[model samples]
Target chain A: MKIAEIVKTLDGSVILGKENLEKDVEMGFASDLMSDVLTLQTSNILLITGLSNVQTIRTAEMADITCIVMVRNKKVTSEIIDLANENNIVIIECCYSMFKTCGLLFQAGLKPVY
Target chain B: MHFQYSIEGGDFSRAGNASSQLKKLLKQLNVDSQLIKRIVVALYEGEVNIVAHAHRGTIDVDIEPDKVFIRLSDEGPGIPDIKQAMKEGYSTASQKVREMGFGAGMGLPNMLKNADKLNIESEPGKGTIVELTTLLR
Candidate 1:
């Protein structure tokens, strides 16, 4: 699925890297733990997390995650956005909780890789 | 290319600066993305451990043509049980560290996973040294 589609589905705002919205994503991983995301490697993955911190961006960069979806109405700080922009990562803020965001995306065909 | 960074404890905001700079350096060197990712993950976790657990420490990164070596040395309350600390979901970090989205007890295991080789030596109540290496190929 294209990130543009995911944004439309979630009615999310692109806080950064909006031009890369058309990038393709194969799967989604929802976790706040950075190590979990690192251990479970997947290509072209979108990471959904509630924890908004520098480590979140660092984890995304380490795993080469295409985009990050901040659920539970978490605000992406300037530092986070700056880091994301530097790493060429796309950020999306969604009002839906983590579960609902993942559910909607999964129902929309972006299944998790177990 | 080689790099060295001093990590100060209790500074959550500056925790991953070393990893960030190394990531940029690796990219500029045109290192393989996979290899770079492994090196970054391992280095970042190690750096965070120093800042969270130790009073202070230093990270030495040796970037070679075929491998990257990262050594972290810290002066703090050393691990009494290396085997237990190596286990996932086991941590000695305080509650304040846990609230920062870290201290999930996954730091050591995650570092091991990312590095091709890991060597840990610690003296309880003295200090600890962790060395990690990742092969480019």
Candidate 2:
């Protein structure tokens, strides 16, 4: 599914990467653990994480995850948005819990990264 | 090309600086995308290892036509048992590190899995060194 559809499905707001709204996301990986995120080899992957920190952005950068869905209404700081923009990653903010966000995306045909 | 970067222990915000730089360099050198991805992931994990566990550290990168070598050495309370530390899901990181979504003990395992070759040496009460090699061609 494209990032735009995922946003619509999850009622998420785009915080950055307006250009990436049409980019297609092939898989989803949800984790609060940065280590787990780094272990996977993927392309066009979406990272669903509630870990609100600069390291979350760093982890996504290292892992080449294209889009991030911040769950549980996690605050997206300016530093985080700046870093994401620098890395060319798209950040989406959602109020749903992690499970609900994943379920919604899965119902919309997003595959798992694993 | 040879490059060196200094890592400040406990500085989580700056953990991936070296990895990002090396990634750009590798891309400019036209390293294979798969190889570059693996190398960067392993290097980033090594970088975070120092930031999360060490006092301070240094990273050395030596790139050859066939392979790239990286060494990370840190000064800190070293791991007393290398075998135990290498195990997945074992971590010594403090609560703060865990709260940042790390300290899950998958760092070394990811490095080992991603790098073409991996070597680790540590001295108890002193520090540790990690060496990783990845082929570029």
The top-ranked prediction according to lDDT is 2
Interface root mean square deviation of every model, in Å?
1.5, 0.9
User: How would you encode candidate 2's per-residue C-alpha lDDT over B13-126 as one tens digit per residue?
Assistant: 888999999988988988887888899999999998899999999999999999999999999998898888889998898998898888899889889999889999999889
Q: Write the per-residue lDDT of candidate 2 for residues A57-113, one digit (tens) a residue.
A: 988888888899999999889989988889999999999999999999998999997
User: How big is the RMSD of model 2?
Assistant: 0.9
For model 1 chain B, give the 10-residue run with minimal summed lDDT.
B95-104
lDDT of 1 by residue, A1-114 (tens): 999999999999999988998889989999877767777656569999998998788778777887999999999889989888988999999999998999899999997868
User: What is the TM-score (0 to 1) of candidate 2?
Assistant: 0.98
**Cα-based lDDT at residue B70, candidate 2:** 99
Put down candidate 1 lDDT per residue, B1-137, tens digits, no spaces. Answer: 67889999888888888998998899999998877888887888888788899999999999887888899999989899999999999988887677666788899999888889999999999889999998888
